[model samples]
Target: MRKRFLVLILLSLPLGSFSQDINFELDFSAVYWAPKSNDTIRISVGNNGRYIFTDSEEVAKSFGSITRRFQPAGGKENADLKLLFDLKTIFMLMEVKIGQNTVLANVDLNQFMKKGKSIDSATVRKMSATPTALKIENNGKKYKLYGVAPDNKPDDLIYMAFNEKYPVDYDTYFSKLMTSATGELFSIDIPSGLLVHVEDSKGEIILELLSIKKKKQKGSANIQLKLE
Candidate 1:
């Protein structure tokens, strides 16, 4: 999945008047039971609003909970969850803009394992690195999300969507987030775990809600949103 959705309501009160940073975490567990083997994929949110999407295949037989903590990459302010979690960009880009098309907040994720070639001279390697960034001039009316490959390599078009501008409201969003009619894109908006399930010849994948934790800051917010 190259692209992805938006806000899961960090605040109950409308965000039009208030501007501050808040941290939230959405936990989910995925599993597939094939008679021969079991597979699992897990996804979660970060305190700074990064979504961690990881995929694992063929486990021995344990479904114990796991939280994979990763330190920020060297010289990189925000750790690439795409790299740390399952080594693929399995999450999509999401955002919430407030007054005057100003981006209030955003979340991002994508599909893993879409590799780009690397030239080391000594050896060639297959590496997948797509940095997600989305921009909208008219505040969610229309969006263009692009996946920029690291090291000035090739880039991929994640998602370009259109919607008539609607005034901000809880009902206006949060029921369902859709990127494209086809399920090529993936998005993780909390509680939306309700609508997330996958089944194919390889068994089934489920997102089970575990917990949600949130904290708000009163002063200036240093929210490092991924999308523009």
Candidate 2:
């Protein structure tokens, strides 16, 4: 009787316990094919919106270990506000810095998709196969999500699996990723409570979950993304 009672109590707990509000770290990678050669770039992201990308695994490892601080330049209130991801406001233009150059990421899907080699309808269909339910065993301290099995449709699988796990109303999520501003779009609504990983359905892109830590309060400093 006691064992059954305990089982019933466990089943009654709110799902929130399984998903607490916390920051996360993620790793991403993708292979790009050129006429003569192909290269893979690696990216790492922290839930606080800091990220670094490099072509070498060693560089990615070093960057992933460093602690980054972001602050405003001038003494301005809400100076560090991320408007596009602030949820309360409508979507706005945003720019991201890569090395010494900065570029605009406010473009729509059609423009973003142009970056990758085009795939046919048959390939798209193969990738869009129904995603399997993810079995997430969340302990009070850590969480884990299993990877999708390798198959013909990497892109469609990624899209379907990612959306199924973390449903965002905005289709712009993919567009944001095209600019390599991964881990930025989830600042809004995410049904999974927290997003640890995401990948492109076609296998061209990948994001890996690394860590989830408490978000520390920020001090007053004027910081903002300088948009062009």
Candidate 3:
């Protein structure tokens, strides 16, 4: 049997002062080969300030639902949804049903790679060992976020080192980080029956035993996001 994959890309505009809320719409398609047949999948991602929704259609069945939220390593909230075939792979179809409208799309995994050639192995290792840190100034307060050894303390010098590696205006970098984090929260879903330990930059686990519950006939799950 051939494996299937789906990828959804959601983009949000830069935040600015406004009464109206910001939302996102995304759609994509993909074709795959199974042992007995070729199949196609469609996916969509939507956010209307308050909540994020993802819808997928595979063959003909539809899956639509709200996402699960997680507290990241910086005391920030994150959300995600996943359809898995096993321990290592995710399913490729999703769908959303609004009051009177439905949105859909498919994912082409190969298309994601088309954006650029592969990175070198050494570069990949370096990135994994040291994810770029971001210093954000929101509402006149500055905060730093990054990955580090599980035992190290978070401080200003850490922020400065990250700043030197990625040279950009702090505000601009902060905005991008917020947008990216929001997108990840919308798409990735935490699995049930597993323990997800969320932490702060100081390596302190703040949230544990997050639960996922599926809404009745809704094709989605609601999460009881709790912090310790």
Candidate 4:
């Protein structure tokens, strides 16, 4: 009788209760829609929520010559720029290391954002004013990052979008991740925590959530796509 009771209790417990706190991973890559060149860039985001930037501007410039003119000043060569933020606000710039280099990220802000004491609608507006950046738009099926024209009107400068077939519970996390990813790449802000749909040929640089991998402890995963 007791043995039967023990088995019943185990069966009644919630599913996945054991593996909730273990190793997890998500891998995202950006690839050109064109099959001719078919160049792909891989970005690795760690469990601690750190998004590392490898190459953004140069890749954008390569897509089209027009992007060269919108380069953010300072010749900021972010070969391996590991920029960390609060995940809530852009002002909370945390210092993290990339190799042996000490990242003076605040200095980079001068070229991209208008520094202020508090984060408000006004500050966000100023930050979004940079021409090189693209704002992310989240529709139900996909995400779009569009740009504004020089005269403050909508322009077809950069039209990029990618899919968001991720889990619903992780929606918040993905939104913030896309925000930092875009910011580090093109100095933009994604107010809505939703993302991805890469399209068109307007010389815009953005990332798409290529793949997501999850696992438990004592397990690891690395997804790689070699360029030809």
lDDT for every model? 0.26, 0.28, 0.26, 0.32
User: In model 3, which regions exceed 4 Å deviation?
Assistant: 1-92, 113-116, 122-193, 203-207, 212-228
Candidate 2 wrongly placed segments (more than 4 Å): 1-131, 134-155, 159-190, 199-205, 219-228
Selected candidate, larger TM-score, 1 vs 4: 4
Worst 10 residues of 4 by lDDT: 2-11
If candidate 2 were superposed on the true structure by all CA atoms, what would the RMSD be? 19.1
lDDT of 3 by residue, 86-178 (tens): 101111223333332232222322223222233322211111114345544422434354443212222421211121221222222222222
Candidate number achieving the greatest TM-score relative to the actual structure: 4
lDDT of 1: 0.26
Residues 5-72 of candidate 1 have per-residue lDDT tens digits of 22333233222222234333433323323332333333333322233333232221131111111112
Q: Candidate 2, residues 144-219: lDDT per residue as tens digits?
A: 3334322432432342223123223332242244222321212222232234444454433344333333433321
Pairs in clash, predicted candidate 2: 72-222, 72-223, 73-222, 154-201, 154-202, 155-201, 155-202, 156-201, 158-201
The candidate that wins on lDDT is 4
Candidate order by decreasing TM-score? 4, 2, 3, 1
lDDT of 3 at 151: 20
Query: Can you tell me which runs of candidate 1 are displaced by over 4 Å?
Result: 1-22, 27-39, 44-176, 179-228
Decoy 1 TM-score against native: 0.21
Q: Of 1 and 2, which scores higher on TM-score? A: 2
